[model samples]
Target: MQKVDILAIGAHPDDVELGCGGTIAKMIAAGKTVAIVDLTRGELGTRGTDLTRAEEAAKASEILKVSARENLEMKDGFLQNSEEYQLKIVKMIRKYQPTIVFSNAIDDRHPDHAKAHKLVSDACFLAGLPKIETVLDGQPQTAWRPKQIFSYIQWKNITPDFVVDISGFIDKKIEACLAYKTQFYDPGSKEPMTPIATKDFLESLTYRAQDLGRLSGVEFAEGFTTEKLLAFKNFDGIVL
Candidate 1:
């Protein structure tokens, strides 16, 4: 099993990119190992096919410098918080044994986002239970739960419990997001224009980060809601 410092979960390919890519980039640059687990192939998206999304996800993973990226290939837009799905995520949680987990927003424009939030949260707890056994690749996996779980802000501007100052890594985050050429704003894309594919939405990415940064005293930032209250050992953890 490959252990990572952080594990990011998303309902679709670009969810993490749109939400917390800058935070992930910043963590990685600081020498923290990170991995991504996409819950679905995004087969039901209005813009692109599942295969293209997978390819784009790979590109984004590379750009973010994640240690590993996996897709559970779940049914898109119809995600359920069932034991079957929870166990699937539990396997990954046990496989990676990450100290921190980042998941989809609690509430979002997409129903799947909220569903994934609960699913991943449940799985995180279940993964810590030794009674809930999981087998991976002929090996018995041990129970492992992340110390902290956070949900990134997406589509909606739900006030974040905390904001990460990603001032310097914003460009890298945008670059990773644009790698999904068919998903985001593009003038030449003749396929179809969805809510996310519009020009305003792309611009919102920057403006939204800037707005949050303005409130938090930074050039750019990403917002997240924590499932558990955080306790800092000292004042050093606070951003000045």
Candidate 2:
């Protein structure tokens, strides 16, 4: 099994790129192995078909340079926080053995986002339970849990517990996000327009990062929230 420093889980194909692409790119540039697990193929998206979204996701993953990217193939717009789904997530968690997990926002405009958040969070906890038996490829998998789980900011402006300074990686994030050409700001296409396809929404990606950076006194940044209190080893670890 391949171990990863971080695993980012999202409800849809582009959710991770929209939420924490810069962070992932920055981490990978820093020599951290990162993987992506998309819960759905975004079948319900107005503009793109599942096949196209899958292709776009692959392109985005390559742009981000993630170690691996997999889709759970869950039904879109109807995800549930149930054992069946939790077990699936647990399998990936055990397989990748990531130290840190990044999940969808706890609350968002899309119902799947919040559902995914709960599903991943519950799985992370249940994955640590030895009694919760799971098997992968006919082999008994050992229980494994991530050291930390954080939810990235999405659709809504929910307060973030902390933010990462992605000063030089914002461009990479935008590039990865644009890789999903069918989904965002495609004026030349005759496809139906969605909230994300709006030019303003596309611009907001950068402006939002700029806003977060302004508040945090950085050039650019990505924000996330954690249920557990964050600890620092020393005062120097914090950015003033």
Candidate 3:
């Protein structure tokens, strides 16, 4: 029943934060509504438990100012681009009726990330199909599809189709990311360490934004890839 201007779907708890937190912050700061759908609790992650991830996710969502956030509770690391999974995501897409949807990169080192990309992309397309009925809270849901689907970049160095300028939002993005207390570096925590979700990882998040910003001539930015080519309606967009 919640309305949102944009909906970002991720394969795991922190993927959205790592991938598009700055963009999301920019959107929210501009008064555009936003939401997040975490496909899984990241139970299979190397560092945190499901309960801990959920709590951290909540904190991050609050910092992001998203209108809504939900976890599909799907199996982590074992997702499949199947009809059943697609239907579940479709249901959410219709329920939220977001105007723009952001999903994971189509190809990634994480098999689950690729699967999530396919699932969300298919669901976004199918959400517009009038015949594919979806129900929510015992009532039939109306068909709706997002106008645009942007895939956020991940671990891979795939060339981005475009980048979002997050110059003023770098701090906000980091704040949201640190909400995942158990995932990132906490010098005081006794939890085991991992390659990602560490202090160095957190530092990289900032520098990554700086790197992308330099390429786009912005103070900070986030990169994204698109399934189809990007287009602008006017010649002004072509101006230097």
Candidate 4:
């Protein structure tokens, strides 16, 4: 039972990369143990097969240097915030026992993204209840809850509650995103063009980070939203 410092959950294979890869890269560089848990295999994606997505996800995880990556095998386009689904997420939370969790955006163009947000957020709360028993590997799991849970921005420009300075790690984020070659911009590929496969979409990754950075007074940054209020112990804890 290896405990991780953070767990990032997404609706599909590349959602984590698209949403918060830079933040993950920055945290990993700071020696924090991070893991990724994708809710689906992305079998319904138009550009690539499940097998290709898995391969690409593995490559991206390698680039990000995540401690572990797991897919929950949930239905790709039909994500549900049901108890069964919530329990599955609770199991992972209990297993990892992460102090912080990053989930998909609360609202996005893709319906699955919002659904995943609710599922992960609800599970995070339910996981801490001792009455909600769960078992993994033939053993009973203990109740656990993360200290913080934040939602990353995606597709939509929902205002962020706070931003993380990822000045030096944006390149790593792009590199990891490009690892999903079958899903992103590629002029040579015969695959049908999707919104995410466009050249502008590829460029948006950098420009979006830059825009967030401009507002935050950093070279590059990533935005996140949280339901609970965030507090700092001292003035020095914040970047000016």
Residues 82-107 of candidate 3: C-alpha lDDT, one tens digit per residue: 88899999989998899889999878
Worst ten-residue run, lDDT, model 4? 231-240
| lDDT of model number 2 | 0.94
Give the poorly placed runs of model 2, Cα more than 4 Å off.
Answer: none
Worst 10 residues of 2 by lDDT: 230-239
Give the C-alpha miss distance for residue 4 in model 4, angstroms.
0.4
TM-score of each: 0.99, 0.98, 0.95, 0.99
lDDT of each: 0.95, 0.94, 0.88, 0.95
Error of 2 at 143 (Å): 0.8
Q: How accurate is candidate 3 locally (lDDT)?
A: 0.88
Model 3, poorest ten-residue lDDT window? 231-240
Better of 3 and 4 by TM-score: 4
Question: What local lDDT score does residue 214 receive in model 4, on the 0 to 100 scale?
Answer: 96
TM-score of model 1 (CA atoms): 0.99
Regions of candidate 4 where Cα sits further than 4 Å from its true position: none
